[model samples]
Target: MFRPLAVVLLLVSTEPAAAAGLDAASINDAAPPSVKLPGPHQVNASVARLEIMLDRAHFSPGEIDGKLGENARKAMIAFAGANGLSFDKAVTADLWSKLAASSDGAAIVNYTIAEADVKGPFLEKLPPKMESMKDLPALGYRSPREALAEKFHMSEELLQALNPGQKFDKAGDTIAVANVLDAGNPAPVARVEVDKTRQTLSTFDAAGKLVAFYPATVGSAEKPTPSGTLKVTAINKNPTYRYNPDYKFKGVKSKRPFTIKPGPNNPVGSMWINLSAEGYGIHGTPDPAKVSKAESHGCVRLTNWDAGRVAAGLAKGTPVTFVESAR
Candidate 1:
């Protein structure tokens, strides 16, 4: 059946790391380190700043979580390449200076929660099964914190870690958040490329210059992505998902066709870019953390914000090339 994309769960730590300088002041003032350090992912001020900078430059680092994870590394590498810098999995000093020079702003800023942020007809709990979601009024966020975290392109864990003891349900409560809301609109895209090997999507201008880059999740082994060239047919915002029984997706036992309502938590997230290939398109996912780390059933998957940004710069008949190797 034409099922909604699979959702992957990611576990993140919410423990506050005051000793590691995870506060707003430290994050805002953090400068890039001259040398790359080897260690496990942890709550780090410098990494947080670097993520914010890369995100602001339109090379999204996926959900900013104060760690130099794979998504962040991919964004850094793409940004380095686009800027004509040599980066070999290490955050070089030259790359850091270039990123800082391009995206000039504080990494973290204080934001007052608005009434609309808490006034949600939020679901108390979202059903795990897709069939169970058909009867729900809307697949909205489960909590105010989830809504706020997605609004600022941050992980829920990072949001909690940044503002400890502060429940996000209260309106007017000021909290520290990543400064990623003002990335600005990218230039019109002339073409799009999805590299399966690198798990990245890049939009290019008419002159063949990179305009924006995003980490994406291509198709999995069971359902490999389409090869060769395709064209964009349509773009839908807050798309309603319709299921067909022929696909017979795993974990879905229903033999009949079904339809799910639209929301950020919907199987397709907030945006859907229909492709020439039937039932195979580039769409957004509910789990931003799994954008590139996880597998997709067949179509390409990007973060909700990244999908929207790409949609804005694209029109009907835009060329979309899918390749197994990096270009």
Candidate 2:
């Protein structure tokens, strides 16, 4: 397999936004995956950089861990398909060449925790059931760390593992974080394809180039998602969720219907890209890690950040097709 250029030096830089410098030891502590691992997800700085680049281009590879795992492979395949590369092509010199030109070199960088990051009227915790959630004023992050993690498109576990001893409450605490690309969302999306088997979604441009990809939780066995192409009919930001008992949604066993106010923790998450299918569309989730692990009732579910990016460039006539796998 071809590889992108790797950093000659294990570079460390103190990145403070409005605070003190970072600990050099903490930056150096960013390590690769243990060599004892097996399978395709081996930790590679080059792959991590690719993940960052893909994210900048709007195709998120889930968590930006430096490994060519499932999300990385899916993103590559989508890129290949969009660019007219061979469907089964492994990482080729051509791919690396293109990626290097478009991608910033490093996969990891130092970032300081901001004062605003720790400030909040945060929720103590959100109830798991939608019925219980309906009683809350608004569904939001349980902690400042959770809010910061989502902001950086990172997992809270990854953030905690990086910082070690310091409480994340203070600003100016510099930490090693995945260097996600800082570009704006991709140009308007033309269509979106959902792969049910891989549990992924790839957004394409009008010219059919890959704009972005995201891991998704499509429909379930009990209430399978519509397989045919669906048309996007609406985009609702910070949407209020109406829980109607007539639908008999699983885990939501409320006889009386309720309305859940808008927030990040809303059942449909930060945004709702409703489809013409009446009951189904691509939306955000309360749990991003479970996007592919768990099943949705019928709607396609993505992480809030990923879903918002998709929604930002989509509109009422854009096509969304559900397929078993990539062709």
Candidate 3:
């Protein structure tokens, strides 16, 4: 196992620049962050190990891609705040020492792919348009590779890059991968904060301790997010998305209403925490990297895992407040 002695952490803005007119289908091609980043695009062993440490601490950095991108900064900011460390400035030896003490494991590990992992219940391909998704059996992951990538908090491309010439579609295949932890089972929530300006979702426990933090795509200028507080009207898991023509979604030519079945790839991803603002909810997204860096059709969108955890922490009448960023 490769160990990192010290990491020069430059405070980079986790918020990426917004692309032009981000509709539902525009999941890939995220705009780079405005801040001058310290690291190059190449994968860094030190950075990957840092990602594992942060994830184990519960400040998820989305997919553990080796690049020190916006999601990693988000995790860093949250972790820094929780521990009373400076969110700004470089990560010195002392900071790395604290992080190293937080977790006890190798950044990478070996796991055997089970028969259930390569099961054929996966979707071969998903339609380009959300309307076309209505006719499909369900909005599941397009392939076993995608499922495995999500399971380990990795990008499909990174997974392939890490294991060249290895087929992820087989059972009983042991592979070296990131030792990422699952977003722990959700805890009870006292309050939820949806910061549209900062594009973040944070929740506080009954004692007002920050329990979770996630990058999110909030309402856009065309469809502005509602102001003030809203109550959680419903918590629907494995939710079905009903697209009404009244919403006037860009590029959606369907005048008639359509129902898209539930799965991780669904437009609303997997979980739906319905808000008091009708037709508006905090939902999940197929594109985890695009959250907080893209525009939405009048909804707050978190990464699927983050959204699931947020939903788990909330009840039928939990309060969700929309406001300015904490910074």
Candidate 4:
């Protein structure tokens, strides 16, 4: 069943709380100051640096918001486990050193806004309902800020906090952004694992070594995810979302089928890895922050960039196994 993609809409706060003590210099510092774990979701240079490093290492912290949120914490633990280090919800010096050593280069870098970035037949506003989206010409980003934020795997609020008073619509404008461009191609994925309990997706190489880890949003109670093994059938980029009446997704009143145009804001985001299961696939999401934090209808949801990476390393017959507990 192709159920409606449930998302916790991001309410961008007007307050500049995420901008506190956040500067390009601090974020680019070689030795970032230690950050306390289980802290509030406040913008801190240390957390930003950690997120960038983890992202570069292919252990995505999901929408680098410059905070030690649940996604970030999960990434840290997974990275530590892969590196033979013990982590217990704390960022010890050794763990920080290991993470820093795993990837080189500054976390934050300056990026000049380009003409293509600002030039958009941008949407003035997007309707909250899925049925209303089918009529639009293209479901492109609502604004340049949103486009840029997704470009660098950053939260819209974090991008704005990094460049206060600077409008993202202007070209030739240099601004601080997360340096999470391309982390390079990973090893060929021999198998893919989705742990529903942990809300994580991991790719393993032929030798059974963990290649990449990502926080994921699995299915909800109303529409639980499928169990057992599945295989990758196809990979689609910039995929259009088709809604079926059989899904009967909440908030969607339409009984007929419809298709939503392809764009970053598209319900399926940028990439879709079709699985052997009829209506189940591991796909990208428009809401990166909600990954692993929200419940999906049935499919496995990942950050758009993370999904792209996973798709790049996947093959047509690669096995995808879903489990309730860690294997």
Candidate 5:
């Protein structure tokens, strides 16, 4: 790994500048006290070790964004959980110590179709079609994180936790869908009902079985949840979000023509089920516990895990009836 030169190239706006270069002096002078290293520093052996562990554990940092963000934290937690290590979002010396000792290198744990059925959170069928790591470049996988997310049956958040430093090339190959059944006995089909007035999301299985229920953050009253029968028009894994300036919240200036690269910080957590109604889909949020109490721009928001499961469970063009909650 090349040692990144410490530099600070200040941008007046969020947009990328055509002529961008590192100002090592400016960055070194203004380095934040919290980071310890100067701003815009390159990946070193420490971060490299972190990245290798994360990748092996299957937390695809996508193109090694280098910045430690929420997705990375989630992956770290998952890795720690698997190892029976107590974890907090903040990085600790203990975590790094464990990371250095791990035998797994940078090799990703690829998911393949197996006879044993596995399931994802929110009821998404597991072992999503076996995709090749090589396919990532063709799929616009800008980062290894994105590529790994598509390859594994998980999200970039999981990847970020594993690797904190790396750059991703968005153009990656797509995987071939390999069928794998869920191991658990299929829960009864659900007849889901949404109540925007009450901000609730309910699911009923095929037998009208009440399998799951959750509180949701519905669209704001001003841009109320649309009223109509809808279907999940499409589903995407680790989808990139194009922020439309026209639809942005007031006082929130989006980096124009910017696409929120797919990862933990992605407004749409991981899987997105586009609805028959335009711009209205059931998706996940970076913050799940904060749902229901909050308001959405216009879509239904669930936890990232929940939304991904929902995406895996629902088929394209699945019928979804929309009606107000009796509440």
Candidate 6:
């Protein structure tokens, strides 16, 4: 349960890009989860900083909302795969120590494998390769299956049939990337319909089209998501989150809550498309698979990629219809 050293105050400086040193106060400023009832996901300043670092490395965490959505986690793993770091979403001490030590960390695009790309001893070392999916090792991959999963920010299970037993760091192999768009025609946007009983979000498009679908975490059965047809209110890019203490929960309540700035760690990822349904809207997340399965205070949850597409495509006042689906 140990968190990384926070260096997010650096986020405030108008010249974050120009500053060259890491600050300790930023690391210590992250509020403990136990005190604030941290959401199922870790959205805070420190995680946001990590997202920025990953993006700088050319491993995009997709919107860098301080909330580690599936893209951020996967990007981190991809970076790890390329650089030989562990792929777990939880930041390790080694990763933290490195992040803390480095003034200007590596960017994601910096690790592209080219014959021209120089190879050092650190770069030469890599994970083993697997002959097939069944050949995957204990770490679940002999090659970069998991690594590639993080690269495109997708679930490893989705790529199982393609490359099995690949080490995350293995070079010169074709790893399956996520099918971002469907075969034939790709949809411009995805619409999420919240099902109270199933607690899932069904993705659709502007033409009343059904594109993709998944389960969703909704407002608790008790809180119950407010039902209504709404429109896109506003789109906030890389928004900072303001945690409200007055908000009530089914089991717990907070007297004083803290507001966190936007980054990969914020509960809301890089983009937030507010809906006409008062506080409810569709937004990006750190975890992709967890989208429909987990609980949101009430808002619709989507992967940063999915959300960004939706947010970017639609304008404020875009009609967003919400209907109660079968439980």
Query: What lDDT would each prediction earn against the true structure?
Result: 0.83, 0.70, 0.72, 0.82, 0.46, 0.46
Ranking by TM-score: 1, 4, 3, 2, 6, 5
For residues 1-327, write the lDDT of model 1, one tens digit per residue.
011111111222223443434688877776665344523356677777888898889998888888767787778777877887766535667888898887867888899999999999899998998999999888898999999998898988889888888889999899999988877879999999998888889999999999898889999887789999999999999999888878677778999999999999899999999999989889898889888888887889998988988999999999999987623
Q: Largest TM-score belongs to which candidate?
A: 1
TM-scores of the models, in the order given:
0.92, 0.80, 0.85, 0.91, 0.44, 0.45
Worst ten in a row by lDDT for model 2: 1-10
Total backbone clashes of model 4? Answer: 0
Give the TM-score (vs. native) of candidate 1.
0.92
Predict model 6's lDDT versus the native: 0.46
lDDT of 5 by residue, 133-230 (tens): 11222223234444344444333543343333323322232222111112122243244466666565555577664444444677886567788778
> Per-residue alpha-carbon lDDT of model 6 for 120-216, expressed as tens digits?
1221122221111112122211224433444444455433322345344544544433322222222444344555554444445777654433334
lDDT of 3 by residue, 81-118 (tens): 66766534555455566666776666666779988778
Clash pairs of candidate 4? none
What residue runs in model 6 are displaced by over 4 Å at the alpha carbon?
1-153, 156-176, 179-193, 197-214, 249-254
Highest lDDT: which candidate? 1
lDDT of 4 by residue, 1-327 (tens): 011111111222223445445677867773534333324555666677888999999998999987767787678778878887756534667778887787777788899999999999899998888998999988888899999999999998889888888779999999999987857867899999998888899999999999899999999877889999999999999999999989887778999999999987788889999999887898888778899988887999998999999999999999999987733
Residue 73, model 5, lDDT: 37
Off by over 4 Å in 1: 1-20, 36-38
TM-score of candidate 4 on Cα atoms, chains taken together: 0.91
Worst 10 residues of 3 by lDDT: 23-32
Q: Residue-wise lDDT of candidate 2 within 1-327, one digit each (tens)?
A: 112221221222222221233322332333322223223423344444566666765667776554456666666666655555543324555655565556554545687888787877678878877888888888888887787778777667555555566567778888766665376777898998888877888788899866777888888987888888989999999899887788788787889888999988898889899998877888998777677878898889998989988998898899998888533
